[model samples]
Target chain A: MITAERKPLDEILSYIKPFKRILLLGCNECVTVCAAGGRKEVGVLASGIQMSMLKNGASIEIREHTLERQCDPEYVEELVPIIDSADAVLSMACGCGVQQLATRFKDKPVFPAVNTKFMGGSDRHGVWTERCQGCGDCLLGVTGGICPIAKCAKQLMNGPCGGSVSGVCEIGDEVECAWHLIWERLKALGLTDQYLEIMPAKDWRAGGGSGPRKIVREDLAE
Target chain B: MKTQSNLEKVLSGGHLAVTSECGPPRGASAQTVVDKAKYLEGVVDAVNITDNQTAVVRMSSLAGSVLVKQQGMNPLLQMVTRDRNRLAMQADILGAYALGIDTMLCLSGDHTKFGDHAMAANVHDIDSIQLIQMVKGMRDEGKFQGGAEIKGVVPKMYIGAAANPFADPFELRVMRLAKKIAAGADFIQTQCIFNIEKFEKWMEGVRKMGLHEKCYILAGITPMKSVGAAKYMKNRVPGMDVPQELVDRMSGVAKEDQPAEGIKICLETMERLKEVEGVAGFHIMAIDWEEKVEEIVKQAGLYPRPQV
Candidate 1:
């Protein structure tokens, strides 16, 4: 799921300060699963903004709404009535959702209330870690199911990068070395021979190198 | 001849090539760079100019390299992937080359959180390995990263990269060095080494792979000025492996004599490392104690770098 965290109160407050009526938009897809931009977060953010505005003796109204998925145009069109009544829309979704809302509501000033972090799943309740870099090329099979592109600090194709100590990354103790985990998994699987096979240089153009990417589906296109 | 850089000549000549670092001043002044270069002159083959090392804002390495060149010393400009994207980096490579700078060290710089500018946005458009490959392509193929042909001469530089023998999963260090060498790094300068035993173990791995023969390998050495300095590196610096015994050695000494003792430890490390099978040279990173480099080199009997 796409994960994110709410922007700081001050930064969010500054974005909506000029507007009198604001809509706190949330997404029910990835952001909801990640607990970042969801119905619950929308209510909490609305109440916090209201309290902050009240303390400042400023008159501001914030309405909360959650779409099934903001990335879809059909779900985004559902926001027309509330968005028409609001002066600005603060999206509590990932960057994709925010851009979707902005594209659908061209006249309304749409702003991001949360910073989209990465594409990852929760390791446990209330704890999320990055598991993929959307490198556009997958090597999990060769890597013993570990994603070195996202997990390794240097994204080394064949490495623990001289910075892995005791299975932990040099970046910090909290981060585990991706290659260390790969090596252990490979050893357990009796594929230790593959460890000596050198990985060739990555073709970054397949990743996020050339520019913004797009996918074309001939079967689904109108 | 790797574009005629003196450091390249020394390393290719099979001498124990000596290189040292000279950080650019925090303020806009060329005097500090010139003065520091003087300390390294004749004692080392070349001087590495750090690029906003530790993420602190300072005089740019490109500008500082030009200043070092003016002093008749070769400058190994350190380029980090943290600040600029491919366009700026490629342009700077061309500009630096045009200015007669013939060597560069590719690095994924220290995170900005470690510096005063903690809030600065980092741009890691490419990592150091890619940077090495890109520079190699530019030099050998005369093409940009996107395959655009350069209309004029390409930057011909002796490519360099860093390694950390202390950082863990210790067995993989040599493999990583091999990767860098495969990516076109002509030389390798390691992080500060305080644990000689650990470093030699790493060197043994490198020799097993015969990687030292693929590229020049220089062991990094930073002389600790005091016990406080030793503690600071052990506690604060990431990936720095300062063995507890060295700290004890410094702590056992009188406060006033710690500096000399620090020099002795460095001298000893160089002497012992000289015997390591794959070791090709010493990269002295005195870090504000540049004055001690000459003595360290002389006492270690590595002075009079062969005039190639």
Candidate 2:
């Protein structure tokens, strides 16, 4: 899931301060589950902004709305009617959703109310941890379902660097050494031989090293 | 003669080679490297020029190696995967070789979090093992990592890699060393040896696999300057196994005598490691205390380093 956190109240306040009216938009996707850019968060932000503005002896109009998905054009079209009533649109979604709003409402300014963090999932109640980097290709099959590219600090392919100590990374105690996890998993599965093999240099071309990537699903294309 | 590096010649000549580390200054000071090179000039076969060790920005290892080489000492250029991608790494290898650096140590350097630049992005395009293979390919096959032909003058380097016997999943450490050797690492320099018992066990595994015959294995030694240094490494430093006994020994001495006690412990470890099977040489990392290296080397009976 694409996780995010709301931008600071001050930064969001600064953006909407220039406009008399703005739409506070939220997403029902990953941000919702993470308690970041859901409908409730939109209501909370709307009230905060209104109160902050009223304390300054001025009040601005705010329209609150939450989309089923902000990154999709079909769902973004639902804002076509209400978007014109506001001076600008402040999106509380990931970068994809923010960009989608920007592209859809070219005339009205679109400000992001939240900061897009990473493509991760909720670790526990309110905590989220990154799981994937979407590095076009995946090596999870060979790595016992662990992703070194996303987890390891050095992104090493061969094995753990010398920094792996007691299943922890040198960077911090909280961070688990990805290679250590791989070794343990492989050992448990009687696949220690796989851990011995050297993974070659990664081809970063697929991971956007070449440039922005695109895919055309020929089977689903008209 | 693979690049005719002095370190290579010493190891190949069945002589216990001596190599020490010299970290480049954070600022651009060629004289600093020259000064450090003086202490290690006749004391060791090669001096390893660290590349932004601990992630702190410093004068590049290539330039430092050149400076050390100019001072009439062989420089072992250390390259880390944390800073540059394959293009920069390959380009720097060619550049370093052109500037007369023949020995290279490949490492996945300390993460940036440990360095001054914690916010910096790390570029690990190739791990240390692959870096070893790449350098060997450039030297032996005259090809780039991507298998393209080098138009002319491929870099010929005596490739080296690092090993840590104290790191966890101890059973796999020997296998990692084997993989490094198979990847074309001509020599292996281990992490600093504070826990000789663990290291000897690791060497036992190395001997079991007969990996000692495949590559030169240099035991890494660092002389602790104080009891604080020992305790810090024991508790804070990653993969360091500083036994409680060593810390107690250091603290038992007066503060003024701690430095000498530290050297004594280093000499004792080197003396013991010299008798261990599969141990090829000693890599003295006198970290900032380079002046102490000569005394350590001479007292260990490794003085008058073999002229290969």
Candidate 3:
């Protein structure tokens, strides 16, 4: 499960103070699981904004709506009436929802209540860490289950560096060197020999960062 | 200790000490809050400002409590540890005190799921009883919650808390009250009591545990004037239970006499509470009916303290 911490109340409130009407939107995907943005979060933000505004002597109407996945146009289209009616929109979803709302409602100002931090997953309750780097190619089989691209600070796919000391990272004593983790996983998988082999070149194209990437799934298309 | 003593005198000596709760409005608005605070100022002994009541974020309870203090009324700042960690809770307590709001009501608070922000996570750093113990320790030993010594010793303020005799099973209610009293709770406000017989039995159990000797317990009473209100309290509110008889009384009475009927029931409830040996006082939560509270007190003949 993905886990996320909520932003402070005052920070969320300050974003929507300008407009009398706001569309407080949420996404039911990863943001919901992590709790940064979700249906329940939207209600909370709306109530908080409403209560703060009322207590401060300014009464603003906030309309709340949560889309299944704000990144998709189909989901964005569902919120047309809510977006059109409001003077401003507060998207609680991560960067994707914020961008989608902005693109869908170009006329209305969109504010992000959550600071989208990283592409990661949760370890356990209240603990989240970066797990994926979207590094253009699949190489997990070569390095056991661990993704060296994310684990290594420098994304060194080849092997552990000279700075690795006692299984700890060189930059910070607290951090367990990712290469250390990579070695441990390889040992456990009975693939210790895999570390001896050198890694190949990295293609950043398929990672979706270099350019606008698309997947045309002909099987799923109508 | 001067204000401490003066407040004890004020509370123990009666003087129509009033307390009201701000449900941290569903949405934020200053006018409604200011109006509610102003309404309670002349009427109540002290106003209990809720800290994120029901976990749906509104104005900060400390901020609201300070606003109440600014309005010239004593505010018992309510703090819930559901959303904050231990460090923030301790800091906010001192902050509230520094802002001239002394009295505090420490609660475990409702689950975040019951709130509008169910998506919001819960941080149960310490339970309500432990929180009281921590504060009392800080005041008595000049130590923080972690047992570290605090720089300047601050005299302990009058710490009040909640008890729910009607919600939990009879045994657990008394046990919880004992635990709270043992945790250095100066005073306790019970959940609203409708069944006087059950309340009397509960008091007997409390006396047996010797809890009454250690803490002053104020019985909580709610006014059920409308049918809708009664239903909501029964179904929605977790710990509160208004008996069927009161609902019948409200229904039997004519529309015009509903107010009188409610007043009569409440007055009788208070009078019956007076007969109980351990009930120190009553905490009247009349919803929006503050004016009726004075009338109920007068009818019950609770003047200048409960004849202590």
Interface RMSD of each: 3.2, 0.8, 26.1
Q: Looking at model 3 chain A, which ten-residue stretch has the lowest summed lDDT?
A: A154-163
- Tens digit of per-residue lDDT, candidate 2, span A81-114: 7888999998999999999988888888999988
- Kindly list the per-residue Cα lDDT of model 3 for residues B13-105, writing each as its tens digit: 643333556554656676667777775555556677888876678888888887777887777788876777678988987787788877888
TM-score of chain A of each: 0.97, 0.97, 0.86
The deviation in Å at residue B80 for candidate 3 is 1.0
Alpha-carbon runs more than 4 Å astray in model 3: A1-222, B1-7, B11-18, B26-29, B153-155, B302-308
Candidate 2: CAPRI quality band: high
lDDT of 1 by residue, B153-187 (tens): 78898999999988766765777787789888999
Cα displacement (Å) at residue A96, model 1: 3.6
Model 1: which residue pairs collide?
A164-B168, A164-B169, A165-B168
Can you give the TM-score per candidate against the true fold? 0.88, 0.99, 0.56
Per-model C-alpha RMSD? 3.2, 1.0, 20.2
Order of quality (DockQ): 2, 1, 3
Query: Ten consecutive residues with minimal summed lDDT in candidate 1 chain B?
Result: B167-176
> What TM-score would chain B of candidate 3 score versus the native chain B?
0.90
In order, what DockQ does each candidate have? 0.38, 0.84, 0.01
